[model samples]
Target: MTSHQPPLWRRAVAEMLGTALLVCIVVGSGIAAQQLSPNDVGLQLLQNSTATVLGLTVLILMFGPVSGAHFNPVVSLADWLLGRRSRTGLTLAELGTYVVAQMVGGIGGSVLANAMFEVGTSISAKDRATAGTLLGEVVATAGLVLLIFSLAATRRGILAAPAVGAYIGAAYWFTSSTSFANPAVTVGRIFSDTFAGIAPSSVPGFVLAQLVGAAVGVGLLVLLFPAASRMADDVVVPHPSQKDGS
Candidate 1:
């Protein structure tokens, strides 16, 4: 029997649900962090990092089987550019659908956070607009996208799923931005009146930086592993096709 390929609609829906799960975990963790340890700055920050790492690990494992678990737009973009995406990859219509789903899912996470945590009562950070903070956003997001591309997107020979968690977890401390790598998560965090929230004005810069970083990551992958990119283009027929059953 031939293996079945999933329809485009199924992939799009999977993307939507995976993106939503990512946002929900990040935002919900922020709310919980506040409720559990309201006044401890260090603890709150650590909680943010820890929760994000753990949530990502679970989500990656859970949804990877369905849609490759790409909740970040940068990952999708890099995959398209690098040619690891399935078939001819996503058509314009499908790409649009995925983007819309991501945005809507982000908004849904924000709205859920608001309802669950009494949003208006919480105090948002006033320092979100500072130059240092914006710089932090840029660096953090870039690091995340780069990691995704290098780890699993273009270079299939490089590390895969489970290692993605360790890569991100370690980056959180080494990178100045604590690795907020995902745009959807960043957008959702804006609605929460908590430490994790980014100022609305900062979103554009953060996302742009992330895209740049993803491209850079792919470029680096090509530079370091020329054979991989070459392999990316050549169609390798399945080995089992040579079996007597054929």
Candidate 2:
């Protein structure tokens, strides 16, 4: 085996590529479910839920070591705020690259889905509507951030990646928005003309809700585990968890 460290560029690129892959699995699954059986709402939802759970598990297990598999800006921001993610600060350049890569990956996924099913380009109403939908997003996102900080922040939970996937997957059903906790992923879904797509007008509300959820989760985390603030920085990898210490 060889030992070498990935530069910051490689780490950031990994983040971008991992996020894109995650969005594809999530949004792409929804598109497939719709095309296969539009009338079977129950079956479609089940398929969507199953795919999201399985895909997230795979992504996390694969990329969690690579880029922390953040896939969601809120998760990244929360980690940074708590000092869990300090290697690559949330500078304009970093944020620009992350958002752009995520969007590009999302669009690519949507396009692939569209080509497969011959569907038109448009956001799905169920994915962008209010009431249960929006509320679900806020709650799901909050819970997700809360879980990440609580579990993944410490070395004790480094192996809890699978649990994190299951958390989000189950939250999708309980949450009104089917667990669209990630702002980046949310934005990408808008481009897909599938059951998981969000309307443009509804983007703000979802983002706002997700942010709020993150804040709330952070607050509770602080209260429950006051020591987190002191220990958050310990989670970062030296040289991006390089195969060999640089």
Error of 2 at 116 (Å): 3.9
lDDT string, candidate 1, 26-56, tens digits = 6677778877999996687678668777877
Q: Candidate 1: count the clashes.
A: 0
Cα error, residue 116 of model 1, in Å, equals 2.7
Candidate 1: segments with Cα more than 4 A from true spot: 1-3, 84-89, 120-146, 153-159, 227-246
lDDT tens readout by residue for model 2, 203-240: 88888888988898888888876655544432222124
Supply every candidate's count of residue pairs whose N, Cα or C atoms clash at under 3 angstroms: 0, 2
Error of 2 at 119 (Å): 3.3
TM-score, per-candidate, Cα-based: 0.78, 0.82
Candidate 2 clashes: the total is 2
Model 2 residue 17 CA deviation (Å) reads 2.0
TM match of model 2 to true structure: 0.82
Clashing pairs in 2: 136-176, 136-177
